[model samples]
Target: MPVARLSPATLSAVRVTLPGLGVIAVAVALSLAVNRLVPAVSPLTGAVVLGVLVGNLPVLPESARPGLKWATRRFLRAGVVLLGVQLSVAQVLQLGGGMLLVVLVTVLTTFFGTVLLGRLLGLPRGLTLMVSTGFSICGASAVAAVEGIVEREESEVATAVGLVTLFGSVSMLVLPLLADGVELGMWAGASVHEVAQVVAAASPAGAAAVAAAVVVKLSRVVLLAPLAAGLSIAERRRRPAAEGGRPPLIPLFVLGFLAMVVVRSTELFPEAWVPMTKDVTGLLLAGALFGLGSGVRVRSLAKTGPKALVLGLGSTLLVTLVAYTGVRLLG
Candidate 1:
């Protein structure tokens, strides 16, 4: 048999750079366009939608897969770094004594509530906890940490994350409007997930709301250690003989993120450099979101679309209503 090989043109066509770059471009464009058209939806959410669509559909050639994967990984890593730039340790301290208590209570309540709701709806225990934790704490990090101890299948984690992303996006739009109408700054703070999403959503509510929401979100993040530790213990008890080989320690990036805040508060980095740091962080996060969207399979999302949508929407409504009521009474 004669040996055959790919031609130069064919090899070039197989490269992922073009398609990956194209997807990023499209995502940014779509996000901007959607923001203009809807005004209510955040550009980040729109970008996520665009990324998912481009990644899932057969919009690119197989030859580009390598490039796409590389791009996605780079983006994700950058996003994590960008996320660090936004932190300020002084802000956490400024939240005051009672504010921290409120955040702690809400996080615990939401975490347990989501899990209980999932179980009542006949969701698997592992999936229930994964979704609950992701919603109650930080998004991707919560999922990653829980996955280490839970031993659930990858599909379950994906399903939970997909639910969080879908619902978290919805919250980004809905909560801001609710906050505006109800003047529930504290509620908005206690309810929203990611700090960036909260700020983007609450920007319309004025700077005070944005500041409050960020404080609340960061306070929730501080619970990650105790939450992870408790979960690890529970997981070990449940598995007994499974030998999970020492529950993975809390990730270092989270500690780094907190440390960056401390550095910022202490003026370790000059004030003039802060803007540059934030800009870099934003770019990194945008790249990460792009990568995350690209990795999603449209078919899988479609298959679970109804369930994810319903769960996410329902959870948002529940959280908003409760938080709004609580904040109004307490604030």
Candidate 2:
């Protein structure tokens, strides 16, 4: 029998990685608990908050660092891949060409405008991109997708996610109070960062408005693949030497996302299984955000200056105005 040789480095790596996985599990559990108690705040948001708390507190040990980092990258990508199951090509098309155009314009403008403004403000590109995607697309989920491509620090991701939650929560309160239900619905669909925020904002407008808002929001979500592809291309252009030549047209995870969308369109899961799938996907994403959050240091984020806050506020206003214009013209 041939003797087997094992490398000490590989053994050490496994030891560290396992502990990190455990840390992620704990964060996921905490997120679930928070979401259960506070339905208004999603598990994804709760996870990030809890991760920050755990990181700052004495609860998280140094040994868990490797696992936390793993969760931040690998888990986030996995969650995003699963996100596609929640969307469908057919659903996006059903929104009608006019409304689809409105969504497209809103997403594209918000994305590019945010990037331009971030440059003007002298903010870091990674942080700016994260905030833009979070605000422009689907909040935390979009942040995760962009994070995978740009590979920013955990604190930057936290900052972007925090901004999204702050404004999205505000929309829930402010949009409903508007005088015109139709306008409120359009604004919510067009401007709000998260699907939950959109629904909360538009629900008061009644079922019809709620239905329209969801369809419009889904149309925006469908653009995530294209956005990721564009960003990947841009990233390659900015750092061709480091990144090594041209990037793939679509990332593997994004391809997985598109595949899931196709699978969903087939309606193979049956209606009863859809909710279960969503629940599972939510859990995975929440855990991933939690992992990202744990890497954040509150002090470091504050040190980055108020430009992030300004960028976030600026992006929010841009999307809101653009969305409102499109909705008025098309909705």
Candidate 3:
């Protein structure tokens, strides 16, 4: 019998590079193809789907694990940093008081309601909270920020994030078509989860609708602090003993995001650099989404199945109806 020989260093390098290379290849190809053909669906969404599908296909060889981890982590971090470039304080404020109130109500109501729904459905508490926060706040960023306080298992976070990304992407693709028929601009504004998703969904609705959606999404983002504070207090009370016998402090990222907003409003950054910052932020968000998808297990996600899909679709419709009716009545 021939003796099998393995060099640990060589094996490790192979393990890391293989999965990373496969995922990147799939993601890039899918993104490019979808962008070229559909032109309507966002490339980021395609990248995410590709990542999740490829990542969960099988366990990587031991030798390739490190390289895969490093690539995914770097991608996520770059996406987050790029996200920051989009937060110019001045534009957010320009949405004014009425738009601000709408955002606050939508975020708070959806978040708390989702939590209740999740609990009633008997979902894991941490997963429930993660899904609720991700849906009601800034999507993946909200999940990441809350993860520190919640101490949820990484698997739970991964599953919740995957669900959010799936539903958010679906909304981006479907909502604009619905808007064309319904002419419900305000409804679309409140229903979509992320700024990018909102913009993508509303693109077909003409400039007026797209502008309205952006304002609505940004307005919701502004409420991140109060929402986080409320959740922190609620979580603390719910798990006083587990959380070091004290309330958790609100995440610092919210503050940093707001601080950046304030600084930008002060006219500190050159105007010429603003667009570049926005582009960078977008790319970073795409990378983070890619990273998030990479960590998810498609088989496990399939287990969530019809129930998850139903919940997401139902909640979205409920929010859309409420927002549309409320806005119409109030306006």
Residue 98 error, candidate 2, Å? 1.3
Candidate 1: segments with Cα more than 4 A from true spot? 1-39, 124-130, 138-183, 194-197, 200-205, 221-247, 329-331
Model 1 scores a C-alpha lDDT of 0.63
Model 3 lDDT-worst window of ten: 76-85
Pairs that clash in candidate 2: 20-67
Task: Tell me the tens digit of each residue's lDDT in model 3 across 28-124.
Answer: 6667687679754455656666657656776434554455566655554444444554556666677666656666677777787877887677667
Output the lDDT of residue 70, model 1. 67
- Determine the C-alpha RMSD for candidate 2 after optimal superposition of all C-alphas: 3.3
Q: What is the C-alpha lDDT of each candidate?
A: 0.63, 0.82, 0.64
User: For residues 144-245, could you state the per-residue lDDT of candidate 1 as single tens digits?
Assistant: 446556656444655666666667667777766555732545666677665556666677777777777767776666666567667877776676566646
Candidate 1 global Cα RMSD: 6.9
TM-score of each model, paired residue for residue: 0.71, 0.90, 0.75
Count of steric clashes across candidates, in order: 9, 1, 10
Write candidate 2's Cα lDDT for 23-58 as tens digits: 788778877787678766878898888888888888
Show the colliding residue pairs in model 3. 11-63, 15-63, 15-64, 15-65, 16-63, 16-64, 16-65, 16-67, 79-284, 82-281
